[model samples]
Target: MKCSAGRKVFKDFLKCEYSEENILFWLACEDLKRESNPEVVEEKARLIYEDFISILSPKEVSLDSRVREIINNKMVEPTSHTFDEAQLQIYTLMHRDSYPRFVNSQMYRKLAQLPVPNRKGSIA
Candidate 1:
C-alpha cells in the first residue's frame, strides 16, 4: 500500500471499479501537505475541491455532510491541511470499503505472486 508499485496496482484495480478517485484524492492531499508556499496551497486546495469535493465532479468521492461543511468553511482561506479531515474520511472509507475488495482482486493476487526485488534490483 505504501510502495509506488503497490499503489499503482491498487489504483488500477480501483479504476476498474470506477473508484480510482479515492486514491487520486488521497495522492492530491499528500501533494498538498508537502507544499510550503501559501499560494500553491490555495491553488492546490481549490483544484482538489473542484476535482473531488464538488458534487458536480464526475470523480467526486463520497463524503458526509459534516466533512463537506468543514471543507466549505476552510475554502475561505485554504491551507495545506485544509483537507486533512476529509482525507481521513475518504481514507477510512477506502480502507473499509475498497481495500478488502482490492486485496481479493486478481490484480492483488498477481502482485502477490511476483518475485520480490532485492536491494540490487534483482528478483530475490
Candidate 2:
C-alpha cells in the first residue's frame, strides 16, 4: 500500500472498521490471483492492513518514500532482511489465513499446493 492509499484506507477503516469499502477492497484483491478462499483472504488482508498501522501510527511519513523506492528497486539476493521481514509479515499473515483445500474442484486428491516458504516467520 502506498502512504496516500494507506492513509485513506486507515482513515476509512477507522471510520467504519469493516465497511463496504473495505469489503470491496478485499473482494478486488481476492479477484486478482489463483487465490485463497474468502475467509483466508479476509484474514490475509486484515493482517497486512494491521501491520501497516505500526508504521503509520509512528508518523513515519518518510518511510512511505523509502518503502516505495525499495519496492521499486528489487533484486532477490541483494536486498536487506528488513524487506524480508516485511515481506514475511505478508506471507505469514497469508499463510496463517490460507490453507490447502481438503477437497478438490473435481474430488482429486490435491487441488492446490502450499509450499512452506523460507520466510522470516512473523509472530503477529
Candidate 3:
C-alpha cells in the first residue's frame, strides 16, 4: 500500500479473489483525505458512496449495517473524513483476512525473492 508496484500486485490478487473493491475503496479514502477543496471533497465522497457504499454497485465493499448507517448519515454533510469509520473497517478486514492469503500467494513469493536496494543504492 505504500508503493505503486506493490499496490498493483496486491490489487491483481484481490481481483482474482473478486474483492478488489476493498483496496479500491481504501485508495479512494486515502485520496479523499488528501483533498482540500470543499467541492472536490464532496464530489469524491459521492463517487466513493456510489462505488463502494451503494448495494447496487458491482464494486461494493463488505460493510456492516452499523457502519453503513454511519456512512448514510455522513453523506448528508460530506467531508474528507466522512468515510473514516468505514475506511477503518475495510482496512481491518483487508489486514486480518486478505493479508494472510496475500502473504502466502505466489505473487508475494515472487515479490519476496526480489533483491532489496541498499543504502548505497545498489541491490542487496
Candidate 4:
C-alpha cells in the first residue's frame, strides 16, 4: 500500500475512533517545525502546545510525564523542535497501536486496491 494512501486511511480511521487529535497534533507539529521565522515559530509552538499539550485542552494528546516536563521547560523559550519528544511519542503510539488496526480495517483494504499515481502523475 502506498504510504500516503495508508496515512489518509489511518487518519480516517482515527477520526472514526474519535482520536483524530493525535494525527492533527502530529501534523501541526510538522508544519510548525517547517517555519523559518523566529516570531512565527514561537507563536505556532505556543499554539500547538495550548492546543495539544495543555491538560485543559479538549484536544490534548497523551504524553508521558518526562516528555511533558521537557515540553513545559522548553515552552519558556519555544523553538521549532519544542515538541520533538512529544511528537515522537505520539507518532510511536499511532504507529504501534493504531497503524496495525488501520491496516486490517475495511477502509484500508479498499484503499489498498486503488491505483496509485506515478511520478509522472498517471495512475500506476
Q: What is the lDDT of residue 82 in candidate 4?
A: 95
Segments in model 1 whose C-alpha atoms lie over 4 Å from true places:
114-124
Best by lDDT: 3
lDDT of 2 by residue, 4-109 (tens): 5533543444234222232233333334233446555445444433434234532211234555455334322222222333344434432343212212112222
lDDT of 4 at 96: 94
Q: Which residue window of length 10 is worst by lDDT in model 4?
A: 1-10
Q: Residues 17-94, candidate 1: write the lDDT tens digits.
A: 999999999999999999999999999999999999999999999999999999999999999999999999999999
TM-score of 2: 0.21
How many pairs in model 4 have backbone atoms within 3 A of each other, for residues 3 or more apart or on separate chains, i.e. clashes?
0
Q: Which residue pairs in candidate 4 have backbone atoms (N, alpha carbon, C) closer than 3 angstroms, thus clashing?
A: none
lDDT of 3 by residue, 1-124 (tens): 8999989999999999999999999999999999999999999999999999999999998899999999999999899999999999999999999989988776786789855456797765
Candidate 2 vs candidate 4, lDDT winner: 4
Per-model lDDT: 0.92, 0.35, 0.93, 0.87
- Report lDDT (Cα) of residue 42, candidate 1: 95
Model number with the top TM-score: 1
Superposed by TM-score, candidate 2 places the C-alpha of residue 96 at a distance from the truth, in angstroms, of 0.9
